[model samples]
Target: MSRYAILLGAFAVAVMVAGGPSFSQEPGQKGPLVVIVNISNPINQLSAEELEKIYLGKRGFWEWGKPIKMVDLVEEDMNENKSARAIFSAMYMDKSLPALKSYWIRAIFSGKGQPPLVFGRREDVVNYVSQNMEAIGYVRMGELGADNVKSIKILMDNKP
Candidate 1:
């Protein structure tokens, strides 16, 4: 009886120490959406400005091909925040939620780029990312796995 109790305690301790699964996440918790591209894509590394330019149509063509289709989540997307923040911060701008509307408006009116094809939920974004070869989109980071989609590293503010 004492041995069983000790084993149970040890298991509990392991759970507590390991923090669950391959990535650190609480049970039932999810992460913000992430912007992912294909692994085979010619573009390996990009500055936020470069990413912004690509999304905004300021820059066209992936290194290996002509213009690639950029996917945007719809207005109601739940995973939009993280993706936006990652993109905007790369552009050296703030990504407060309120500012996003204005950003889209500017992009639309100026004809610099089109707003992303918005989706209702993270699952939709994930589905889209997994299926489309030319598609690049975002989903909650924690939600990503070794699925069909390949993730590109977004340049954090000043980090290399």
Candidate 2:
């Protein structure tokens, strides 16, 4: 199928459609961000609450598993714009930075654990995940490849 078709289909099937130019365009034409994780990871097929806990730092590790490193691509840069936010929000629950920070602070004070590393760019997240098998992060799906990291289903779909 055409890339547009794939994106439209993804949006239709996905539970949440993030903000972006319509995914029905060429690969680069779409502005939606992509979320990713190690293809080998087995702990993430979790409920939205569990995923939120992991991403929000409310929960320190994978369920019944050791602490797994969580990573995020910073939004300060131009590339990690609405697309990134859209993808991040879809993966977890609420999509607010302050909420995330508050959760992180709570985690740190509670001695649960630290928040995932933050990178200045999307490529940085990919590189970090690529180098570490235990790392999990997100990026623009269009920019993804097989060499560095692999894309995981967004818990929900984002399109339209």
Candidate 3:
């Protein structure tokens, strides 16, 4: 088995011993969302401003010249109270769901760029990021387990 599988198994055991996993957090809390990329990706960190620009389609390529491929989780519903999508949107995109949708609509209408590929499941997002060297995506902290993907720190205020 791969090292990641072993680590993931250990984590599962620890969670079970600690009374199972708890996904809940207080309202307005941040940090539960993690950004991930293919293990081959050389980038280990990104600033909040850079991430926002990438998601907004203002940035197109990595510093090393690879075209960035972004993946996104589908909003659960109109009321995405505290989902990963909600947290990522509020923190990185700085827009509500409706506003982000409108931004994408305009972007596409003007042939500027298309939104990231959307996946309904966190596992799918992780899998895609792992498979594509240029891909980046976000997931709940607990959802990352694949050996082929690695989470990079998001620098806020120029600090990681």
CA lDDT, every model vs. true structure: 0.59, 0.62, 0.83
**Candidate 3 per-residue lDDT over residues 62-153, each given as its tens digit:** 99998999998874442454667666887786677778889999999999999999997788998999899999999877778799999999
Maximum-TM-score candidate: 3
Give the best candidate by lDDT: 3
Tens digits of per-residue lDDT, candidate 2, 1-160, equal 7999999888776744554322233334345555566666654444556556667666765554666788877656344324465346644656555556776688799987787788866767877787776777777657666585776554433321
Q: Write the per-residue lDDT of candidate 1 for residues 16-128, one digit (tens) a residue.
A: 68742222333343654466765555554566666666665576677667556666544243254334344333333334445656787998898777765666555676677
Candidate ranking under lDDT, highest first, comes to 3, 2, 1
Winner by TM-score between candidate 2 and candidate 1? 2
Q: Which is the better candidate, 1 or 3, if ranked by TM-score?
A: 3
Worst 10 residues of 3 by lDDT: 20-29
| Total clashes in model 1, counting residue pairs 3 or more apart in sequence or in different chains | 9
| TM-score of every model versus the real structure | 0.58, 0.62, 0.77
Cα RMSD of predicted structure 1 = 10.4
Note the clash tally of each candidate.
9, 3, 0
Displacement of the residue 120 alpha carbon in candidate 1, Å: 2.1
What is the alpha-carbon lDDT of model 1 when measured against the actual structure? 0.59
* Model 3 CA lDDT for position 126: 89
Off-target runs (Cα >4 Å) in candidate 1 are 1-29, 73-93, 157-160
The C-alpha stretches of model 2 lying farther than 4 A from their native spots are 1-30, 42-47, 62-66, 79-87, 157-160
